[model samples]
Target: MGQVHQHVHIEWRGGTCRVKWWSGEYHANGRKRYESKGGFTDEDEAVTHGLDKLYEIRHGTHVSNRDGATLMTDWIDAWLGSLDHACTTERNYRSITNRHIRPFFARKTVSEVDVIAYRAFKKHMKRTLPSSYGNAVMILGMILDDAVPRLIKTSPVERTKRRGKYVKTHTRERKKDVAPETVERLARNAEILLGYQGYVLVWTMAVTGMRPGELYGLTRHYCYPFWPASDPQQDPKEADRYKDDKERYGRDGNRLPAIRVERQVQFGDGKREFFPPKYASYRTLVIPPFLAEMLARLLALHDYDWVFPARMGGCLGSANFSEDYWKSISDGCPERKGPRIRRPLPALPAVPDFKGKRMYLLRHGHKAWLDEDGHSRFAVESRMGHEVPGVEGTYSSVTVAMERAIMTTLQERWDVAAKDGWGTPNG
Candidate 1:
């Protein structure tokens, strides 16, 4: 136990009192160290403050003077250094920290960032950077929370409560899914604007629900059924293992056509590279026969490394694809004169409900389609590359029947669309 001592000053008319207390901590040289606070006229108030410090120390909730003085920038650096995140994720964190966190909390100690300061920061972010506000707050909270008991006592970031429920202060507009007919219309428009490749790209996204990055990064080696058996990239052992499996090959002794989603194109620090799919959700997607035929035709037309390449024969970047390809497809392009006077282009009609929308909505629409078809939860989640939570995910597994059913339903939809003359041209 430590005791508080009173100090008297004779320079004033009457006197003054102050207190200091120690909690049995020692310095390297064996000198006794103490935590002290002055300027209290009342001895009782000083005693109360000392007692609170002692209690905090005993309960292991105390923030030491040195630790409390740690600047927010220092803590953020230490916290970020301790984490192991993906390259893109780390880049985003650093970007957010430098842009929002560092400037606002510059030179402010961790302990000095009280609830009021945090609230003010939130307000500033909401007004100036509404789109990035939520992510900034989340990253800041993570950094501060990691400093507990070391740099600061506790985090000031708290959830806002309203009407007996906790809700997000900032919300974004939800992306809506398009109907199957709308997808076909988009495909038709894409064909007119970007040739057969664009038509295949739109249909592939609508049916497979692949992320834009994954679709753009897809190579010929991963596209099965069309992937050459004698190709050097083909694993002989893997092929031999599944060669006799009836469920995998089907009862008719024919191999299933599928695409292996193993990698995605990632652009970071102005460099484009191949990275594992998001969440490392490497999966094989089974395709219907009609789609397989479409892929076959597409492959026959090109010997490029990437299945879908830009007009310049390079991997399609999302931004460029959106602006040069997707925008013209979704928002209609005016008729223009071609190089040859007799081959003038005709005006392309816009697909309804698709204006100002992102290509990602096709993924959402695919999930909805699977759900509407009454597919099993395990099958649907697996197909979407999502991990089902809880015991259901642990116990359930996607079966041959599920894949067959999915293939059958997709083929039926293609047949119906083809009957309506919406199928790919010359496919």
Candidate 2:
């Protein structure tokens, strides 16, 4: 309403009449915005429509035809910029949107994307990129949902697909969870190849259920030993860190030694940045006495802030760790010209048809162990840093008894590891 400008013009086209108009919009300290539309048969109609548009602009309900004609790729760029998601999520969304969504829909107008086009896109995704089909659709739906009231009147994403519908014939290869005994062998091989640090890393993951990033994010400051009220002597720092956990577990002091998961390190923009755990998966983890003792001894050996550091004294990047350390041990060191020639893999127990399983399998194995030990669904989910879902996830509380039971179950595994000479302090 600050300053309004308007213009109307007419043109004679091959025995036909055409009219065009422009509305110059400037309000307060904002930039002077201009809008124009052309190709109307009647000058009166063009003027009326232009005035209506100008009115809407002044009233703050303006819907721009130019916005409706916004290309999918441009809209996607804007949408991604507008979001405040974690860096990891931002990387993932960008990768998928650019790789899959853009090539097909980039040229189409937002207003022109109809159910027919959406159905074809969905069918194409199912036929060619079945594994990524669901995530692609989800990201598309999120964008369209935001666009509905602003740019487009309706979204073309199918209701069934949006609700997670899947065809009966399609299948995805599920990641296999290894047995706890197999994890022990993996740890033993890790020690032989990468030394004691590797051994402790794999063993801790198998029993503690900490995600890879969380494990890498661990610092000595976060590790806690059991400090029950019943015991008068305790590490002052451990007591301070476990204060909340102690109160939650009724201060009985019978709880297991624990580690606090405060942050995760992820890769982005050619560098690693520390971020909160994915999906806010922050929780305390309690370990058995043997692993706790080993960790304590390991901590005393170095003054590095990180509990597990790379060879050069910084956090271990997952990619470098996987390629240089994990793969060499799991398979064998690759052929080279010098002292780094190919080495034979140690004779670890073989699982038939095992196709180079990654380190994440240890986490899955830990969840399986908890399930096998008959822990409550709530306790298992809580320990795994997953929301339990429904009313139970909201109302349920993890009590001292549940934690003690989990501790006992993990202690049994440690006992087996001790006999196998896997998790000892000097390993």
Candidate 3:
């Protein structure tokens, strides 16, 4: 049972009615606790509120005001500490928390973050950080939902649904695809700008659909012909099976060469290190014969550990590579006059349909090529290192016929490009 009472102030100057207060008593862990709320004008209303509180406590749905008073910043810290995310994921979450969440809700308590406050935060995120708005909202929801009844009764963030239909706040833009001829043009332009290595880089990305980090981290040990045997990350059982099949020949034998995608280059805390590929999609990619030969030639020329080292040396960084290499390659570099120029550098022609486009478009182009070739969905998705959801992924596997068809199609494209006067580099 609970009690409702009104406290009258004799020294009051203005008010004729005294405010009523309500309180409920409960026991837990061999101790008695009190839950209360004040500032009701009617006695009956105060009593009803007290009874509701008592009912909630009895049904194990009571959320204490004291616990809800915990600051959002403190709760976020605790939540982040409890997570066991990967290094890159952890870094992203910490960055979003510090840059967006903590700054906006620094002074607010967990319980104070109601629907109104959440809506205000959403508008602020959309206005100031439109590009990161979705991610910020997701992170906030995760943090608040984890609080549950311990800090707050329920989360204010609700799913965007309208009349039983899910609503998307933003429309996703489809990735642009680069044509085979355009890929050739881009590779030639890269050669003109940064030499043969740049040409090879462009062609490899277009043909194989490798991510920039995976390409940058590609070492001689992981390249075609040397991989599987030299790949330290490969499972021992799989390596043994490969070795056993080395001398054996099937109807569709191991004609196509492969490169192992075991790791990717990651730059963090002012240093570079190798991390598993995105979503840990460690896989082997079968390459066309021409690409295998091109890689061999490139390796013969460079004794460096990395297949594609920076012009000065070491791994190619994203910022510098994008500015000094990809920008000039994708978008034509205008001939410039300089104090140190012995002769004027000629303006390079930009690749058609690639102006102001990202290098990732090449990966998308490769997938488009696969889909255009009428390859199986399972095989194409597997080649692109994407996991297909449900039973399809678990049961379906990339077959030897699929690999052969891919190799045949890619080789034909290269031969056609060569006939069109876009021959391989002499180096």
Off by over 4 Å in 3: 1-60, 161-168, 172-177, 233-254, 318-320, 340-345, 420-423
lDDT of each: 0.77, 0.71, 0.76
Error of 1 at 10 (Å): 17
TM-score of each: 0.82, 0.75, 0.82
lDDT of 3 by residue, 286-323 (tens): 88888888787777777888888775557874446777
Clashing pairs in 2: 228-253
lDDT of 1 by residue, 214-295 (tens): 9999988777554434134445766653343324642135557777787899886688888888888877788888778777
Sorted on lDDT, best first, the list reads 1, 3, 2
Model 3 C-alpha RMSD to native: 5.3
Candidate 3: deviation at residue 290, Å? 1.1
The TM-score of candidate 1 is 0.82
Q: Residue 333 of candidate 3: its Cα lDDT?
A: 86
Residue runs of model 2 more than 4 Å from their true location after superposition: 1-63, 123-131, 161-177, 225-242, 246-255, 328-354, 416-420, 425-427
Clash-forming residue pairs, model 3: none
Model 1 stretches astray by more than 4 angstroms: 1-35, 40-55, 162-177, 227-252, 336-346, 419-427
- lDDT tens digits, residue span 1-427, model 2: 1122265455556544444434354547876555666666665676677777767656656657677888887888888889888887888888888898888897798887888888778789989999899888889888887887567767887775444465574565576656556666666666665556667788789888899888887766666442333333235866764566656532235545777776788887878877888788867777777677767766776677777776456787555777776665555444334456565444444333233767777788789999999999999998899988899989998876888788888888667545644565343
- lDDT-best of 1 and 3: 1
